[model samples]
Target: MSLLEVKNLKKYFATQKAVDDISLSIDKGNIFGLLGPNGAGKTTLIRMITGIFYPDSGEIFFDGKKFDPVNDVGLIGYMPEERGLYKKMKIGEQTLYLAQLKGMSRKDATAKVKDWFVRFGMESWWNKKVEDLSKGMSQKLQFVTTVLHNPKLIILDEPFSGLDPVNSNLIKDEIFRLAANGSTIIFSTHRMEQVEEICNRIALVNKGQKILDGTIKQVKQDFKENLYSIGADSLPDTTGNEPYEVIGKKEQNFIVRIKPNDKPNDVLQYLLQQGVSISSFNEILPSLNDIFIKLVEGTETARQFQNIKN
Candidate 1:
């Protein structure tokens, strides 16, 4: 059974539809990416899932049961994009307070907070006030508080914000560790590389609607343009109109879009027959960033066209 499920969920504020008829299911131990452009329905959808807002229509299921905010509060951890730390509170005290509010006993919260501080190398910062920490340090403290209770499900929105590369890697490794230990995660971010690295599946929403949903591999394959990148000392000019189109070029490098049904081997044979020594050859698979720009821009263009027609 899926760890979380939403069925035709919808939410509206006045005349604006924040989330419209979105449905998604996340299985246990998987990192599911909730992705979209700015002002898209991603935030609204997340709020509904986390019980910060009730859907105007449809239903959500948690652990195979209908979600009841009061009863299911302890089962999930949510870290919003905005920092919620109390500036005047000491790090250790604040973490303990947050954990206890999440239903953990004070004793258990203190012990877990101490262990987390040691793990994150923040033992010395225990007595330091939140206002004294740098942006990155505060981000780390927020992360510790979010996970202190060891909730079965975790939702992180823009978790890497304000984190330096080293600290980002630290959190990335911890995310994997949590997932490996049977925790389900809902990751929301604008960083495509992070999603590509950690998410097994993703759902992209835009303008209050779901535009894309699938495993990362499936989505990429579906968006594949059959482009190939070749690196060599030099590339021969396709003066005779070779079977492939040269889409990009740089000094000693070329990206070609092979025709439908054309094999890479055939392209290689042609290059060899032309006396071209290949230094490198590989398919130019689209990155998540590439796909995101394409889909979002395409949707916007279509919307503009529709408005013109109307």
Candidate 2:
């Protein structure tokens, strides 16, 4: 079942359509990726969902009921791209304060904070102020505070930013654990590779609109160019009657595209007839980054501000 749903959501600014009639649903226990280029209205959409902003029109449903930003906001844990921590505050106190803000009892919040600090090897840093920690360390602390309350919906914007590979994996594992334990996550990041790796389903927003939405596998299939890579000892020159056309070559692999009326099997059969020995045959699906570029390219390099009349 969908844990969160947005229908015909619109949030407009005086000079721009920050979020224009967008709609999507995120299922329970899902790690959903919300992606877009800079100035694509993703932040605006997220703000509305998180209750920092109200929609100009349309509806939001949380856990099967109409959204009440005042009450439901407590169920969401949002870590914005820009870090928000008090530089002068002690780590332990800050974390506990944030948890309580999310409606956790003081005693419960302290217990959870201590557990997370120990788990993240941050036990020694409790009394240290935020400014004293390194960027990566601060990031880990921010993450701990965000999830300290065990929110039902955790929205992490660039959660892995500023962390080393080891630390990145640490947080990644926790994200997976959270979803496995029934927490739904909305992961927003510009790193397409990370999205491809971590998200099972994604929605791509561009210029205040949702241009793409589907599972990773389904989206790849939808945008596939039907290209294939064949690795062999040798490849014969393409004959006019061949079932496929060799489009390119890379390191002993010939990249080919099957003819309109032909299948991969037809290509293999034709290659065998020409005395070719195939070592490997694999279809080449476009990467999410490639698809992202293909769809958003040729549009404005930056979103242009416009005059909104009304």
Candidate 3:
């Protein structure tokens, strides 16, 4: 069953559609990537999903029931891109306060805070004010509080923003650990490589509309370019008059985007037939970045083509 669902979600300003007919779903224990360029309605969608704002036209459901902004609030743990914490308050004190605000009892919050702080080697920070800690350290404290209540769903917007590489990996590892422990995560990020590595499914939104949505692998395959790169030692004068049109050539061999009738086996046989030594053979698969740009640009090309056809 889906842990979260949005249907025809729309949020608009007087003269702008902040989020326009956006819709997608996420299953339990999976990381869903919300991707788009800045000012592309990503933040607006996140706000609606986090219950920070109401949608003008749409429905949000959680666990198969209509989603209520209030009732479902506690069930979600949201860490905004902009970190917020009281800089003058003691670190431990602030964490405990926030945990309790999330509905955990004071006693439970304190105990949880202690366990987490010690595990994170932050036991000595119990009395240090937030202003005394480094940016990464401050983020750690805030992150601990965000998940201390063990929310069923965790929504993170650029969760690694201010951390160093080591600290960032620590947080990434924890994200995967949380999923392994059955926590569903909604990961919103602009880092395409990270999305490729961590996300099981992604929904790419542009200009407040969903342009693509599906499993990462399936989406990549759907956008495959049907091109192959062949690296070889040497070949015949393979040029203009050659049966295959060499579209591009790199250091080792030629890069060819073959016609539909050009079979891989036939290409290989022809290369060998020409006495060209084959060292490496590989097909080019579209990267998430490639797919993203293609989809976004393809929308415009498709519209232009349709206009011409009409």
Better of 2 and 3 by TM-score: 2
Q: Runs in model 1 with CA error above 4 Å? A: 239-241, 298-310
Which scores higher on lDDT, 1 or 2?
2
Per-residue CA lDDT of candidate 3, range 1-310, in tens?
7999999999877656778899898999999999987667888898998899999899999878899888788788999887789989988789988887788899998899999888788999999998998888888877788788888889898888789989888888888998899889999888899898889999998877998999998998898766778897655675654445566878886777666676778778888878888888788789999888877764443212111110
Q: lDDT of all predictions, in order shown?
A: 0.89, 0.94, 0.84
lDDT of 2 by residue, 147-264 (tens): 9899999999999989999999999999999999999999999999999999999999999999999999999999998899999977787568988888989998999898889999
lDDT of 2: 0.94
Tell me which residue pairs clash in candidate 1.
Answer: none
- Rank list by TM-score: 2, 1, 3
Q: How well does candidate 3 match the true structure, expressed as C-alpha RMSD? A: 4.8
Supply the global lDDT for candidate 3.
Answer: 0.84
Better of 1 and 3 by lDDT: 1
Q: How many clashing pairs in candidate 2?
A: 0
